[model samples]
Target: MECSDARMLLVVLMIVVAGSRQASCNVVQFIFGDSLSDVGNNMYLTRSLARPSLPWYGIDFGNGLPNGRFSNGRTVADIIGDKIGLPRPLAFLDPSLNEDIILESGVNYASGGGGILNETGGLFLQRFSLYKQIELFRGTQELIRNKIGAEATDKFFQQSFYIVALGSNDFINNYLLPVYRDSWKYSDDGFNEYLMMTLEQQLKLLHGLGARRLIVFGLGPMGCIPLQRVLTSSGDCQEKTNNLAINFNKAAEKLLQDLSGNLPNTSFRFGDAYDMVNDVISNPDKYGFDNSDSPCCTIGRIRPSLTCIPVSRLCKDRSKYVFWDEYHPSDRANELIADEIIRKLGLSQLNTTNSFSQSTAPSPAPFS
Candidate 1:
């Protein structure tokens, strides 16, 4: 299908589903993941070099002040929150923040450079691992229970969406790092299996913690990012990395299937970010982008070596570029990705025949 047609269909699907739902049920969002979904959590960390609270980081974001997002503007979490009629959740670590209102609205526990595995982004000692994020959520749970009691808190979680966008850092910063010896321990498939298993365990923990509506975002085309492009002699996509991502996406699909079947009264949706992003990279013009291989802000070969600093030359039009820096997607790209996610969620909701009835359990459609 044409990209525009697909996007339109998705919008229609979302409208249908939203209209069918109870108007009184306020949708809250609890987000977790790495830089892609992080809304300034890293800035609160003293040891993180992944901080984006500097000039040029939020140049495209109105007001031209960095809000700690690693992109030129809003991340996927912010856009998705807006789509679901929720304000962007405040970062869990941000001090001087209003904890009561923010926690009730929901909290973004994503930390830039974080991953599923505790050791994934070890270079950044301060990054909150998925485990740590979950622990923090436990605290939030306690607060919710204290305010509204356990029964209301359980219903609150059941009505909320738990969004997780992770795994890229595991491959990019851990397995693929020169210093890491993960290569010696397992083949690509083996490593992916281990990662998926760990992810499943985390999801189970979330399930136990009262999450009923889960949205797990798959990894994107990591090989096509500027960092990987500059590492290649021909500046082409790193096919090995791409294959690994594809394999992991497939594994994630199965994991979601298993989780849905085993975790009663729960809904699971997998967002195929790999396919969505690969399409943009393959046909940048179709997405109104002029550059996909090069970053909008960079220095020295446009790779992660020099990194995007204040002194680096910034692109005049960030919307023309797919990537804002060596790794993260620009706000434009993130908007597209977020649209795809909303579409996927809508599709899942539409396919499930009796989504609102507690007595009926609808089998979710498989990941596309």
Candidate 2:
């Protein structure tokens, strides 16, 4: 381990040992990731692609209206929050976010098309990188410190669960695209090493900034997504792409384990969405998914449209489908993904805080 990694971990331990704020029963959540977990951060970015601004995108949400979520209802983050009985963390870009709201439920910095690498989603024109998301959280911490105190803010963060769902876009959007120089700049092995090195710095950055309980989500089988499948003549999952995902997940899982062993009072767990998601595709019936190949919503007679637009053809039954569009999973699949991650990885960090109790009254949203 690097000296800096140890120093960062030391800071976290120091904060915990000296914290005065009483631990609350509620476990606040700070989420960071890509489109799979995006609640609507992309909607605010006018130039970003993959914006679900049309009918049926969010028809099943609590209010039966689109609220920035990409699925028919909730993202994996939403389902996980619901299962834990915690309020959904509001988007960091939401106009009404304030310190009190963050202190209560935390914030979501995940954006549509986001990736671990800063350049991973450049084609999208607008998205938050893992580094930028952490910066936003740092800003949140500063505001909370001013409102409360540094020690109190540190204590609050010490017991909170930090969930990160990224990586897929680093491969799908950047490494694979000829438009991005990453393809020629690094060989397959070199690219993997680059990503690992970058992720290590990012994970350390979060810890140095006061995060203790961190969950880094691994990449699933990108070869199995509807878009990837359609690219092949056989319409089959690309084993080459699957290999990339598997290799990256292995490296990531090791990084998480190494960090956790060296960092005291910190739980660095890996959310292995790869294995379970691969299983779902291999055995659709086992997960109540009948169609795991083609997406539920699509356009085009031969090669399907790259994204789910407002005028895409809708499936008769969305629940039975594994994917919502060419690139993202269905609401049902996201629910299962959340269940698998929580059950297998074990969110013991969430137990650090008794609860993130709900407010008795509505919270007034504050502008950033």
Candidate 3:
């Protein structure tokens, strides 16, 4: 064989070995959710309530400029990506970001106004709901197939990690709003059943499409959000809403357990973000947070400005605060929550698609 051909063969061997050794790195965290998980997908879409274009938004990012993140800097998803040894997952709509990034570390299909239902927001300003995001995920896989061949794409699918964080919008926008009061007739049992069924179908679709390992993030305490507190006039946590979230999470956990049972050795896990955020609310100083009832980003305990910008009021030290705005956790706060999730899953990193320490190469595809 020619020397150049030999050199090319060596490079191929190295790449194959790298991909195999990193089999445990299964997670290419495909994020989907509302403002909490949105990393800027909406910024590239259109003008909507979900867009984050103002100051203090990206203060913590290395760039020191707003990049459409809902926080002062580094969202939970971004921090999780950093911890998992992957590049920050790119917003699916960022023109500068491309398919190479998606193929490498997954994509962020989250939109600020996103919810369970498409009608949750009107057209023009409509965001990518969880369902829509999953559809986009399928498209991403097709992109992979075209770029990396069907065989390699399947290998990536069997080894990659899928992380899902969502559901707040269903509670806040669909249930709480009068526009959907009659439509959804929001009750814990009814809502839980609907969400669980939706989740089950979605998971089944993903599994059929090649997702093996999955980590599901449960809802946080929506009652504690400044929006709920201010809009509902309760000024206290809403037990009913929180209970609904708990029910949804319970049903989801059961569904995941059942799915795992049928999927053989593939691991499907759940993390309780509700408890993590609630713990911060219940015990602030323990987490180094000074306040839970109020956000550091807006005036008093009122909701965040219609347009989240840097010039808007902000806290002096974000690390000392639990939430940056009415609906999102501060960067430090998300880090703590992500740490707990890691501990629960026995993970050393937050963004991995697989635990490189635990996974093995494809394992003969279960058919060979």
Candidate 4:
């Protein structure tokens, strides 16, 4: 061939290869952690706290199945899934949903009793720990590879997003639950550092296994949870407990940013859950919330025993409240929060095809 023809052919080949790589980056989302984003993952498992069979859990979802979600309706994860244009995440343990469904958008590995550490308290029996959850994800991916053949699965791996929404249970169970205080034996700094070490290790492991992007959520205001309010103190929030969450979040933020810098073609980001919860709490009216201090559920005339759903009196207007129960938010509230997160990560308005553009949409409300 002529030299000029050879040069032109090489240029065409390069363009085709680049186009192929971009096409392969089809978005995959994997969710992990506790009740906050549990969806119905906990329901498939045999557990008393499971909510997949109850009222108010899927009031907005049309199908009306509780699906084990711990809210009066859809949780934040559902909203996020919608915003990203994916179906609701399938619970990893759901027997009804096959691996085909689980492998599509992704699988939700979150469990109600999950925690950062194995010994963290108050989790339901047979729940997977954060470490164990990662293992499940790894195993699922491998199963996908075997089912679809390695080449197709490799493309799925590269374009996927992994979300880790955890750490709250670690603080609540290990520190707040009475049963764990004597067993875990962690001082404040000791606990924080230990959790960080586990988190760092987990991120590295995921990265090694082909996770290209991750969003690790920081703990919210633990002291403000209705359950914590009922058990640890009066209506007043415990500043010390909230402070622990803040410390952990700040540290994780720094760690993730550093990890992104060191790793090529890999991004690790922090989800500012702490600020989002605080915003709703500090200025309830701004987000159409009338009460952020107390849950909308009915409580006993004396000490509380149950959440504000099914058996409890639900607020006349769930949108007016920040929390639906002790640890979950109403669907509207979750949609708003998901909007903020989508804006923060610039994940809004994905492309019609598998490609995405930098969102030109107006930024949502500032998180207080």
Best candidate, lDDT: 2
Rate residue 244 of model 3 by lDDT: 72
For each candidate, C-alpha RMSD in Å?
12.8, 10.2, 8.4, 7.0
- Model 1 lDDT on a 0 to 1 scale: 0.80
Per-residue lDDT of model 4, residues 215-293, tens digit only: 8877778887776676654577888889989999998999899889988788899877568768888888887778887
> Model 1: per-residue lDDT, tens digit, 9-97?
99999987754442225566789999888878998897787888777777666566787888877888777666555645778887755
| lDDT of each residue in 257-318, candidate 3, tens digit only | 89999976577888776677788898998877788887777765444555454556766776
User: How much RMSD separates candidate 2 from the native structure?
Assistant: 10.2
Q: Clashes in each model (backbone N, CA, C under 3 Å)?
A: 0, 8, 17, 4
User: What is the lDDT of every predicted structure here?
Assistant: 0.80, 0.81, 0.72, 0.71
Off by over 4 Å in 2: 1-25, 300-302, 348-368
Top TM-score prediction, candidate number: 2
| Model 3 TM-score on a 0 to 1 scale | 0.84
Q: Which candidate would rank higher by lDDT, 2 or 4?
A: 2
Model 3 residue runs over 4 Å out of place are: 1-27, 122-124, 181-186, 232-234, 301-311, 349-368
What is the Å distance of residue 42 in model 1 from its true position? 0.6
